[model samples]
Target: MEMIIHLIFVFCYPANNRQKLLPKSPLGGCHSMKILAQVLSAALLLLLSTELLAGPLSEYRSPVAVVLAKDGHWLATANQTSGSVSLVDVASGQVTDELACGTHPSFLQKCLDGQHLVVTDTFGGKVRILEINDGKLLPKATIEVGFEPTGLAVSPDGQTAYVGLVATGEIAQLDLAAGKLVRKLEVGAWPRYLALSPDGSRLAVGCSGESRIAIVDVPTWEVAYTEKLSGGINIGHMQCSADGKYVYFPWMIYRSNPISRDNIRRGWVLGSRIGRVRLDDSEYREAITLDVPGTAVADPLGITMSGDEKRLIVAASGTHELLVYRRADLPWEGIGGPGDLIDPKLMRDPDLFGRIELGGRPMGIAMADDNRTVYVANYLKDNIQVVDIESREIVREIPLGPSISANQIRQGEAVFYDARHSLDQWYSCHSCHYNGGVNSKAMDTWNDGSALTMKTVLPLDNLSKTGPWTWHGWQVDLNDAMHKSFTTTMQGRRASEEEKEAILAYLNTDRFPPNPFRAKDGSLSAAAQRGKRVFESSDANCASCHSGDYFTDGKIHDVGLGADEDQYEGFNTPALVGIYRKVRFLHDARARNLEEVLTDFHSPEEVSGTRALTEEEISDLVSYLKSL
Candidate 1:
C-alpha cells in the first residue's frame, strides 16, 4: 500500500514538482523526467488494477458461472477460483461491483422478479441470495443447504429455489421468501446441474455420475421420471426448450477400451455429446455425438438457446469454442443402443453446426433478449466474451480486471485446461482429472503394459507426495507421467519439458475443501473412532499397504484385485485421503461405491487376506474412511 501511494504521487505530480524528487545529476533533464512520468503512469495503473483484483481473484479468476440482467443493462459472473461474484455494466464493459462469496461459487440463477440473484457456493454448501438494487448487489439472505451445493434453479414467481447438492446426491428446495430450506428430494449421484422448465411445472436434474437425468414434478415436488443416458459422463449445463417439450444438455461419453490413437480418432475411447430428453411425454430421448470425424469437441460446460428458439448455443470449455447448432438441423433421435447413437459424420452437413473459437475456457453462457447477442464467461481469461450470433464472431471482451503476470504456475494451468494441444481439440488432461480432482469414469491411460486394463481416474490432490505413479506402480517420475498422459492417454503430441514443469507447479496447488463428513472440529466420530481400531488392527490389516501420514505406503501390493489380462502383477497402493468424494471404487471400477467395495468386492478377506468384517464392523469402517 505504501509503495502504491508513493507511485501514485510520483505519477500524479507535475513534472517540475517531481524534479525535486529526482537526482540532481545532469541526466535528469526535462525530457528524461517526462519519460519517467510515462513509465510511472503505466506502472501505477497496472499495480492498482492487480491490487484491486485481489480478495482471491488475482491469478486464477475461474469465472465458471455467468448471468445476464433482465433489462440488458448489466451482467454478473460467479467466479469459482476467486470465490466472488462480479457485476459488469453492459455498455461500459467494466465491473461495477464485486462481492466476495465462498469457498467455491458455481452456478447462478436469476428470478423473474429480476431483483433476486441466487448463487450456489459449491464447496461451502450454501445458497446465497442477493438483491440487485441501485446497480449493485447486497446480501439478501443465505440458505444452508448441504455439502457441495452446485447448480441452481428458481421458480417463475421467484418464491422457490432448487439447489443441487453434489456430494449428498439430493436437490434442496428452498423457500426464497422465507429464506430457508423447505425439504430435500433425493436424486442420483452427482446431481450437479438443475434446469426448471419454462412453465415452471418440472425440474430437470442432471445426475452426471449415475449417467441419468431425474425429472421432478414441481407441483408435487417428486421425481416424475428418471431417464438413463448411454455412457454419459461430465453432464454439464442443461436448458429446457422454450415450450418445455425437452431438456437439452452437453456431456461427454467414455467407452472402456484401450487408449489407442485409432480408438480416440474413432470416438471409441472418449467423446463429447449433447443429449435431449422429452419432458412433454417423459418417454422420448435424443443424443448427438458432438465430436466430428477429424475435429472433436471437449468439455461442453454451458448451454443456452436463443429467445426466438431458432438457435442453440453451447460453450465447450475444454475446446475453448462456442458450438452453434441450428435448432431445425439437429440430428435428434432416441438413443436405444450403440447403433442408435447419432453418426459423428452427420455434424459435417452444411450449416448444421458451427464453431466460434473462444480463446479461454468458456464455462457459462447467457443469451440476451435480442437473440443475436450472447455473453459468455471465459474462465481462464477473467473476462466476459460478447459474441454476435448472426455474425458468428466475437464482438468484444469485457475484462473483469486483475491482469496477472505470466508466471509458471499460471502458464501450466493454461496447458492443463487447453484442449487445443490435444488431438484435434478433443480433450485435455482435465477432461479426466476434472478441476484438478478426478472424473467419474474408469479410463485406460495405457501406462501399464496391458491394453484393455482400465483404471479409475486418480485425484490430483497431494499428487506430488503420492508417487510411484500409475496403477501398475510404473513411471516413478512425475514429469514422465505427465508426458505420457498427453502422448498416450490423450493421443496428443509430446508435451514440452517446460509445459510439464508448469503443469506440475499448478497440480501441486490443487486442494480439497474441508471434509463435510468429518466433525466441525475435524475429529473422528464415535463410529469412526471404533472403525479406526479395525483399520489399524492386524485382523483387518488395512494399514499394511495404506499406511503413513499421506495414507499410502507408496508401494506395490497384490491386493487380489488385478484382472487376468493385466500384465502388471501388482497394483500401486492408492491413498485414502479424499475417498469420500469418489463414487467409483477399485482399479477397474467394479465397485460402484465405497460401500460396495467394503461389503461386496473388496471385503477384508478379499483384499487383505484377513477375517471378513461383520455388518457392524463394516458400518464403522465406512464411517472412519469417510471422515478422512
Candidate 2:
C-alpha cells in the first residue's frame, strides 16, 4: 500500500511539477482548495514514513513570543510562521488547544485582566484579543491597527493599548472599549517592543533600527526623552523593574562602527549584552556581556528577571541556549570601562551562573511567582521548554503541535537563521537581514575584495529578481553569492553544495510587503497618483533605470555619488518596493532619510530631467516612491 501510494503521488504530482500542486500562501484565495489538498497529502505522507517524522518533531514554525496564563496553569505561544497560538497545560506538558489567529501573529501578551490575551498579527495588520476559559483560547475580538503591528502593550488599567507600527514608524493607541484608534504618536525607526514601566507613567519603545529607546510619558503621549544605547545595533524584549527604577533588555553589541566579518575571527566585532537604563535619569549602561572572547553568545531575544531579583535570564535565540546570570555576581559598578570588555570564562566566571542548552532557538521567556520555574518559547523546536531556574535544567519539553514538515525553502531558512554555521556561533544571516528585511546598518563587507570600504546593508526582499548581487554587482549567480556570504561575511567554513542550493531556494521565497501608503479602498492617494505620473514621465526618466515590476534594471550605473572609501565606481540599483521601512539611504548610508536621498544625493538630471517641478510635485514623487 505504501509503495502504491508513493508511486501514485510521484507520478501524478511529479517532482519537477510538485511546486505547482503545493499551495501559494502569499497569493491566498485561489489556492485554498489546493492548500487543503496539500495539507492532506502531507499528513498522509507523514504517517507512511517514520524517518520523515523527525522533522515535525524538532523544527520551528517561527514561534515569536510566549506568555504564561493568569493562573500559571497554561502557556500561550504566538507561532508566527504557523499563524496560530498554542495553549499548553503547564503540568501535563500537553498542548490543550491550538487556536487559529490572524496571519503571522508575532507578538503575544497576557492582559492585566488575566482572562484576556492580546496577539499582534503582523502581516494581517490587526490586533486580536482572545478569551481564556478553562485553559482553552477562544477568539474574543480583533481590531485593525497600522501596517506591520510588531509590538503590543496593554495599559495598566487595560483600557488602552499601544502598538508599534514597524513599517509606519509610529505607535497607534487603541481604545479597547470603543474598539477604535485613539491616536498615533511618532517614535523612532522600526520600534520592535513597547515596554511600560511598573507605575505605568512611562513607556520605553525599543527602536531596533536606530539603536535608541524612546521614552514616552503616558499621560501626555509625547516622547519626553530618548536614551541612546552605545555599542548596540538591535535591541529586543525589555522589562521594567518591579519598583520602576530600571529597564532591562538585551541588545547586540558591535565592537566598532562599520563592522566587518574579519573581526569575527579575531574575536572583537560582535557580541551580545544586557543593557540597563535608569527610568528617572535616562542613564543607560551595558550591564553584563553574554558572550566571551573567542565564542559569541548569538542573538539574545527575550529577557526577564526572577521574582526575587536574584537571577537574570536571557533567551539566546541564535545559540539555542538560555543564559543565566546571578545578580550578586555582576559587577554593577565601574562598567563601560576597560575592565568590562574582558571575556568571562564559563567555568570560573563569577557572574555566569549556568548555560542551559535549549537545543532550539528561544524567543520569549516568562517566569512564575516562585522564580524557580520558567517558561521559554523554543522558536525552532516548536515547543515550550519548562526550565528549572535554580537547577539550570530543562525539566520539561511540552510539544505544542505536530512538527511542521521541512521543505527546501524551510531548510534554507533554517540555514539562514542558524548561527552554528558562523564561527563560534556568533550571528546568522537573520541578524543582518532580519526576517529577510533590512538591518539599517552600514558595514565594511569587503565583498568587492577591498578593505576599508563601507556599503549600506540592503533589504533582501525580492532578492532573486534584483541580482548581480552586492553594491558593485560582482556575483551574478545567486548560489555563488550566498556561498561567498557564508565564507566571507560569516567568517565560517564553506558550505556543502546542498546547503548552497537550499539557501538559494530560501532567497527566492522573499516578497515585498503591502504598501501602507495606499488608501483603505486599495486605491492610490492623489499625491501618489500624481507621483506615479512623474515616475513614468519623460521629465523624471525614473522608469529608464527602475524599469521592471521588481523595480531595477539589473545593471550598475554611476550617478556620481561614490565616496573616497568606496571600492566600486557605480553601485547596483536597489529595488524600491519596500523603501519606506529603510532607515538610511545611499550606498554608504550618507543620507539619513528618504527626503535627503532625492534632495542631496540624487542628481537633478536623474530625477527631474529638464523640468524643475514645484515643491508639491517633489512631495508627490516622494509619496509615490514610498508607495511602491
Candidate 3:
C-alpha cells in the first residue's frame, strides 16, 4: 500500500482559502518530534495486526509525456505502462478517448494542423502517426525507426520529423510524406529529449547519458555545437525559451562528488535545479537551485514557461508538487559563473511563488494556450491533473481508466518509485536507476567507510541472474543488498522482510530488451560472428570469467585495477548484456568509453589474456559485445 496525502495547499493561495487546512499527519514534516513519536506508535500497532499490515496494493499507470492540442480544445497524454494515449476534454475535464498507441508510448506531439498526432512507441521501436478528428484518434501509419525511440520533434514546415533513438545514440530524420527514414545522424549516448528552436534554425538535443546537449544545425543536419552541463545528470526534459535565446531544463544537480552516504542528510549530494544555457555561444549560462530555506526540492522533471513568459513552472516529482516561480523574482543578473556553487542563498528568499500539491509522481507537463491551465501526467495515479495556475489548486483529476488490482511485482515497482522510503523524501530507487538503467553518475556510497573509489551506476535489468551485487561485490544476497541500500544509501530504516521479498520479485521481472544489432532473423552480423569466435577463443580468455546464459561466471577478479584506497578485494564481473547502453565503464568509471576500457593498461592482457589483437579484431569484438 502506498502512502498518499491529498491536501489542499493555501500557502500562496487566496486568504479566504487559508482556513481550509487539512489535519496534519503524524509523520508529515521533518521537525515534529511529537508527530514522529505518534506515527511510530501507530506503525507498531498496525504491524501487530495482520489485517492492517496486509493492505491492498494500488496500481500506477506510469504516464510519461503530455501535450496540448493545437486547437487547445483537448489534452493528450502518453501513458507508458498502459501503451495508450488518453485524450481529455478541457472544458468537461473528462476522458473523451483512449487510443491504443503501441507498446510503451513515451512521447506525444500534436501536429501543427491540429488533426494529426505523432507518438513514439519506445519499446516497440516505432513511430506511430494517428489522425484525430473531433477528439477521436485514428491510426494512420507506423514507421519503424531505430531501437527505443523516445523524444520527438516535427520540422517547422511539418514535412519532416526527428526522433531520438535512445539505444542507438542517434537522431533519425523521417520524411513525413513517404513515411520513411531520410537519414540518421549520430549524436551522443541516450538522446532522450529534443527541442527545436522557435525559429526552427537549431535543434537542441539533451543526451541524458552523456550529461551534454548538442545543438544541431537544422539546415545542415549536423551538430553545430555541444554544451557540457556540469554537475547535472539525466537531462531529460528541456524547453526552449520563447525567443530561442536559451533552453531551460530541469536536471538533478550533484553538489559535489558524494564522498559518503552521510552527505545526503547534510544536503551535499543531489539537489533539484533549473538550468539555463545560451544557445548562441553554447555556454552553460546558469544553474539555479530549487531548494528553499528548510524544504529541499528533488527530481525536478517537467519544465515549461507560461504564455506570458512571466512564470516558470517545474514539476517536482519526488515532492509531488508544482513549484511555480515568478520570472521577475528570479535573480538572473546576479547568477554566477559555471564553476560557482548553486547556493540557495542566491535565489529569492521564498524561491517559489507557490508549491501546489499535485497527483502522484508528475512527469510531463503541458500548458494551455492561455497558460493559466496546466495539464500534468501523473505517473503513479494513472490520470491527468488539471491545475489552475493562478489559484494554485487542482482543478480536476481526470482518470484515464478504471484502476486494476496490482500483484506483488507491481507492488514492488510502486515501492521502487516511492520516495517515502528515503529520509525526508529525498529520492527513490528509480531516481538513480532511471528507467531501470543508470543515471550516469559516479557515486561514493561509503559502504566500507572509504571514499577514495567512486562507483559507476549500473543497470537493474537481469538482476536475479547477476549475483554478488555492486561493483565491489559487497553483498552476495539480494536481500542483504536491499537492506544495506535502504539503511546506508537512503539513510532510512530497514524494510520489512515481506517488502524486501516484493522488491526482489519486481527486480526479477526485468528482462533484457532485444538487441537492435541483430537481423530480422535474430542472427548476428558478420562482424559480430567473427567477434563471437574471438570472445570464446583461447587468446581472449573471456569465457573463463564471462560465461553462462547471463554472461557472467558469478566471480570477482582483480585484473589489477583496484587501487590501494579500495576496501574490497576485487571487482565483480559485470554482465555484458545491454552493454551498448552504458555511458561509462569499469568500477571506478576511469574508462569513459568502451574503446578506452579495452585499450587501458592491464585490460587486454590481464583481463582478456592477450594484448596483441588487431584493430579489426577489436572493432568486431566491440560489435559483438554490443549485440548482447
Candidate 4:
C-alpha cells in the first residue's frame, strides 16, 4: 500500500508545491503525467484484485440471509461466501451498495433503532452493527460475541440483542446502546437460532443439538421452559407469531433406522417438517410433515408468515423451492408418533398447501411490505429472487454483484447442497456436513456396514490435507468413498465420474475458520503454552500419534472409544484442528465437550494408562485444546 501510494504521488502530482518550483514529472509533461497516473491506477487495481482473488472471489455474493428494512425500501442480504452485506433497493431493483462486513456473514436483521442493522459474522464470532444512510452502510461497531455465532434476535426496543453462539451452546446478550456483550445465557447444545415474542416477554431458543426449544423469560433473563422436539435436527429460522401465541420453525428429522429401501419408502429414513411451539404452554406443540410419498421436501430452512396471517412460507434449500400453506387451514393438531404426523394424502388437498419451484439453493426468505412478494436468498444462483405469491412465480432475479463463470468447485458446492440427487429427494451431503463441517449429530451412514451404530460427523477443515477418510480409516479411495456416501448413505443415485471430480474439488477447498481463541498476533496464550507442553509430554502420549501441522499421523487406534457392534477394530486418529468448534467429541460422540473428553472417555490416563492429569492440568489442557 505504501509503495502504491508513493508511485501514485510521484506520477500523478507535481514534485514541488513550495518556492514556486515545479519539479519534473515522472513522464515529463502534464499529458504524460495523466498517462502515468492511468498506469499507476491500473497497478493499484491489480494489487487490490490480487488480494481479493486470493480469497474466494469466484463465489461472490452468495447470499445466505435476507431481511427487509423497516420502511421496506432496502433489502439487506448477508452474503456468506463473499463476506459482505449487500443492500438492494426495492423500488429500483438495483443493488445500491455492497459493504464488507466480516468473514462468513450468515445472518442479519434490522435493529430497534431502525437506522442500524445487526449482522452476525458466523465464523468470526462477532456482531457487526452498521448504520444505514441513503444507500450506503457505515460500520457503527463490531462486538466480539463467542465462537461460531450465527442466529440472532434483537429486542423490540433495539437496546438489547441476543446472538446464538452455535459451537459454544450459548446466547450472547448484547447491549446495543453500549455496543458490547452484556452476558452469555446458556441454552443447550447448538443453540443456533432465536426468536422473540411480539411483546418481548419471552425468547424462543432453537437448540438443534438437543432437539428442543428453550423459552427464556425476558424479565427474569432465564430459561422458563424447554419444549422438546424429538427426532428433530437442522432447526432453521424461528419467527414468533404476531399474537405472540406461537413460535414457528422448519427442520428435518432422521428416524435413526437402518438405511434400507423399506425404511426410505416408509418415510422413516428422513422427512421434512414445520413445527410450532405454543408460547403460553410449553407442553403444547405441533408439527406437520411437508413431505409426500414419492416427492419429498428436504432441508426446510427459513420460515415466515404473511402480514395478514393467511399464508405460511418455508424455504426448502435442499429442494430449491418454497412450500406455502394456507395458515388457517394448516393441521395444527399433528402429533408425530407411529407414522402419524406425516400424511402424504394431505399434500393432495389443494386448499392445504402448495410447493413452488425456484432455481438454485434458496436458504433465506424475506417478505415485502405488501406481504404478497418475497425475497429469497438463492445460494447457488448468486442472486436474490423476487417471487409473487399470487402467481406463485418469480417476478425477477436480482444479482447483488457481477456474476462469474461457474467452476468445478462452485458446481460441486451446488451438488453438495442439492437434494435432488438423493433418493426421494430426502437430503444432500450438506445436510450432514453443514457448510463443510460437522452437523454435531452422529447417525447411521452404513459406511462401516453396521446397523444403528451412530458415528460423529467429522469436520472437513483442510479437507485435502487430511487424507485416509472415515472413522475406521478403512476407505483408501477418495472417489470411491464419495460414491459410496452418495449411493449407500443417502440411497441416492451414483454420481458420474465428472461430478465426483467436481465434488472432490469442492471438498479440497474446505478449510478451517480462523481460531478466535488465539491472540491477535497468532501467538498461543500462557495457558495454551503450558497445555502444549503437557500434550507433547510422555505422560500424555498424545503427540506420538497426533503429530504434524494437520495434527494427525493418518493412523487408526482403539482409544477405547469404539462400539462393540463396530465392523472395524480401531477408530481413525482424527485431526485436532478446529476441535474447539465442535460441541460433541469422540468417535461415537459420547462426550459432550472438551472437558468431558479430557476427564471421562478418552482421558490421558485412560488412553495411555499413564499418570492421571490434575484438575489444573485438565483446565489448562482444555484451554490449550480450544486454542486449536
Model 4 lowest lDDT segment of ten: 13-22
Clash pairs detected, candidate 4: none
Q: Which residue runs of candidate 1 sit more than 4 Å off their true CA positions?
A: 1-58, 336-350
Question: In candidate 1, what are the lDDT values of residues 491-587, reduced to their tens digit?
Answer: 7898898998988887887446778777657888899999999889987788888899778998988867777888878888899998888889989
lDDT of 2 by residue, 484-532 (tens): 7888777788989988888777777633346767765668889999999
Residue 180, candidate 2: Cα error in Å is 2.7
Model 1's alpha-carbon lDDT is: 0.81
Q: What is the lDDT of residue 250 in candidate 3?
A: 81
TM-score (C-alpha, index-matched) for candidate 3: 0.86
Sorted by lDDT (best first), the order is: 4, 1, 2, 3
Q: Which scores higher on TM-score, 1 or 4?
A: 4
The alpha-carbon deviation from the true structure for residue 336 of candidate 3, after best TM-score superposition, in angstroms, is 4.9
Q: For each candidate, C-alpha RMSD in Å? A: 8.1, 8.0, 13.1, 5.6
For all candidates in order, the CA lDDT equals: 0.81, 0.74, 0.73, 0.81
RMSD of 2: 8.0
